[model samples]
Target: MQVLTINGQRRELDVDPDMPLLWAIRDVLELTGTKFGCGQALCGACTVMVDGMPARSCQTSVGDAAGKPIVTIEGVDGKVAQAVQAAWIKLDVPQCGYCQSGQIISAVGLLSQNRKPNDDEIDAAMSGNLCRCATYHRIRGAIHEAARMLEA
Candidate 1:
């Protein structure tokens, strides 16, 4: 049995240690918000906050994630997360919506550390996340809007 603190809940999962955290999160824990994009971690679709830093769940092992705080889109809350969610909705950032959860997780992670990020910074931070709809412009705008909301 492996104990994982996910989304503020202590879940004791009966699974292999080598299993990817994504599977543990999605298949075992039933939190389907975190996606499985590129299993190699090139795509940020599986992004989740592991100890407050954005980590690719596809590449992260359940063993590696043990004892660390994992935050998925389902449980992501706080000032920054709320602002990002609001900004995303207000800006209409989702296209197909497949990648929005991962995008939101990454955005919340970035904004948690940096209250204000410029275009270049936003792009750099969000570069790993791929939006097939090519909604990069709207994503950036939402991040900026989220930042603005944070300031107010």
Candidate 2:
């Protein structure tokens, strides 16, 4: 039995230590918001917060994450996350939506570090997350909007 704090809840999951945190989140805990894009972590679809920093769930092992707090898209909260969500909705950032959750997670991470990010900063921060629908423009706009909303 392995106990991990996920989304502010202590969850005891009976699983292998080598299992990816993505599997623990989706298969075990049933939180499917974080996606599986590239298992190699090249794509940011499996992004989540581990100890308040963005981490690729696909590459993170359950054992390594045992004592840290993990926050999935389903459990994202606070002003920065809320602002990002609202901006995502207001800007209509999703096309197919498969990558939105990860995009949102990455956005939250970026805004948490720098409340105001320029286009270059946004590009640098969001470069890992890929949207097959190619909504990069809208995503950038949403990030900017989220930043403004955070300031307000």
lDDT of 1 by residue, 33-151 (tens): 89898799988999999999999999999999999999999999999999999999999999899999989999998899899999999999999999999999999999999999999
- Please, what are the lDDT tens digits per residue for candidate 2 over residues 51-125? 988899999999999989999999999999999999999999998999998999999999999999999999999
**How does each model score on lDDT?**
0.94, 0.95
Residue 77 shift from truth in candidate 2, angstroms: 0.8
Candidate number achieving the greatest TM-score relative to the actual structure = 1
Displacement of residue 41 (Cα, Å) in model 1 is 0.5
Q: Scored by Cα lDDT, where does model 2 land? A: 0.95
RMSD of every prediction: 0.6, 0.8
Residue pairs in steric clash, candidate 2? none
TM-scores for all candidates? Answer: 0.98, 0.97
Model 1 residue-pair collision total: 0
Runs with alpha carbons beyond 4 Å of true place in candidate 1? none
Off by over 4 Å in 2: none
